[model samples]
Target: MEIHPLHPTFGAEITGVDIGRPIDDDTFARIRQAFEEHALLLFRDQDLDDEKQVAFSERFGPLEKTFSQNPAGGTLFARQSNLDIKTGETIPIEDARMVYQRANMLWHTDSSFKRVPSLCSLLSARIVPPEGGNTDFADMRAAYDALPDATRQRLEGLAAEHSIAHSRAQVDPNLLSDYQKSIEAPPVKQLMVRANPVTGRKALFIGAHCSHVVGWPEEEGKRFVRHLMETAITPDICYSHQWREGDIVVWDNRSVLHKATPYDSKKYKRLMQRTTVAGDQPTVMQ
Candidate 1:
C-alpha cells in the first residue's frame, strides 16, 4: 500500500488496500504504523455496511459503545445523520438532534469526557450531501511544538477537567439536562499535554471539553484553556477533509482535535457512522 501525506504535519491517504475485506497481518502492521506516524489516514472508494464497518474497525482494537445521550445508544456505532433512524426522514432544524449536532462544530477530542479517552476513531461516510459538511482536524503535536517556552512550561504537570456537558453548553446552555449531565463517568481529567506512546511525540491536549485546570480558580483556568485552544488551531496545523461517499477515515484521538462543518440539514441528506477504539489505558489519573 502507498501512503500519501495530506498535510505537512499530520494526515495521509492510504491506497492499494481494500479495508472492506480481511487484511493480512503484515499489511495491517504497516497500516497501524502509518496511523501512528500520520495521526489521520483516509481510505476512499470503499463501501461498508454496518457489519463490514464493525469487522474492519475491530482490527484496530475493541470499540466503544454509544452512550445513552446518542441516538444509537448501546450500539458500537455512533450514528451521525440528519434523518431519524427509525423514520428515515429529515429531522427538523429546531429539534434537539440538530442542537446536539451543532456542538460538533467546536474543536474537541473524541471521548475525552470518558474516564478513559479514546485511542482512535474510524468514521465511515455512508452518505454525502451536495455541499459543506467537511471534517477538520488540527495536529496538536505541531501545536505543542509552536508554543512559547513559558506556555509549554506552564502546561507541564498540570491537569484539566473534561465533560461532555461543558462542551455541549458551548452551543446551547440547556442542551443536556442536569440528569443527563450526571450520567456515569461524565467528568474526567486529562493532562494539559499528551505524549504519544508509539510515535514519541508530545501534543497539546486542551479542547472544548476541558472546562478548567484542577487547582486554578474556574475563570482563570478557563481563560488559559481558551488561550491554548487558539494556539493549537493555527492554520498551518489544520487540515479539512471534504468527504466523498464510500470513504473511511481513521484518526488518533490522543494527538489531534477535530470539528464538524455546517451543512444544510433540512435540504440535504448526510449520514456518517463512527466507531471509536477504546483506549487501552487512561490518559490521566482518575
Candidate 2:
C-alpha cells in the first residue's frame, strides 16, 4: 500500500490495500507509523461491514463502548444520523435529539472529559449529503510548534479541566438531567501540552471541553483555554474532509481536534458511524 500526504501539516490518504482482511505485521507497522506521522488517515471507497470495521479497529487497540446518550450505546458503534431508526423518518433539525448533536460542531478531542481520553477515533461515512456535512481536522502538533517561546513556556506545566457537562451546556442544557449532572465527571488535571507516546512529538491538548486551567480564576482560565483553541484551529493548521460514501477516516484524538460543518439535514440523508479506541492510561494526579 502507498500512503500519500494530504497536506504538509496534517492528513494522509492511503491506497492500494483492502482493510477488510487481516494484514501482516510489517504492513500493520507501516500503517501505525504513518498514523503517528500524519495524525489523520483517509481510506477511500472501501466496502466495510460492521464486523470488518470492528476487526480493523482492533488493530489500533480495544474499542471504546459507545456513549450512553447514543442510540448504539453499549455497542462499539456510535451512530451519527439524521434519520430515526425506529420511526424511519428524518428528524427535524430543531428536534431535541438533533440539537444535542450541535455540540459536535464545536472543535473537540473525543472523550476528553473522561478520566482516560480516547487515543483515536475511526469514522466511516455510510451516507453523504450532497451539500455540506464536511468534517474539519486541526493539527494541534503544528499549532504547538508555532506558538511563541514565552507562550509555550507558560503552558508547559499547567493542567486544564475538561468536562462533558460544560460541552452539553453549550448545545442543550435540558438534555443533561439532574442525574447526569450529579454523575461527577470530576475535573482532570491534564498538561496543557501532550507528548505523543509513540512519536515523542508534542501537541496542544486544549479544546472546547477544556473549561478552565487548574488553580486559576475562572475568567482567566477560560481566556487561556480560548486562546489555545483559537491558535490550534487557525485555517493554516486545518484540513476539511468532505464526506463520500464508503470513505473511512481515522484520526488521532490525542494529537488532533476535529469539528463537524453544517449540512442540509432537511434536504438529504447523512449517516456516519464512529468507533473510538481507548487511551493507554490516565495521566492525572489522584
Off by over 4 Å in 1: none
Q: Give the TM-score of candidate 1.
A: 0.98
lDDT of 2 at 167: 82
Number of colliding residue pairs in each model: 0, 0
lDDT of 1 by residue, 1-286 (tens): 9999999999999999999999999999999999999999999999699999989899989999976667676899888889898999998988887788788899998899988889899999999998999999999999999999999999998999999989988989997877778865468888889898887899998788999998899999989998788756899999999999999999999999999999999889999999999998877778
Best by lDDT: 1
Question: Ten consecutive residues with minimal summed lDDT in candidate 1?
Answer: 177-186
Provide the lDDT at 274 for model 1.
93
**Scored by Cα lDDT, where does model 2 land?**
0.86
Off by over 4 Å in 2: none
Native-to-model Cα distance after best TM-score fit, residue 110 in candidate 2, in Å: 0.4
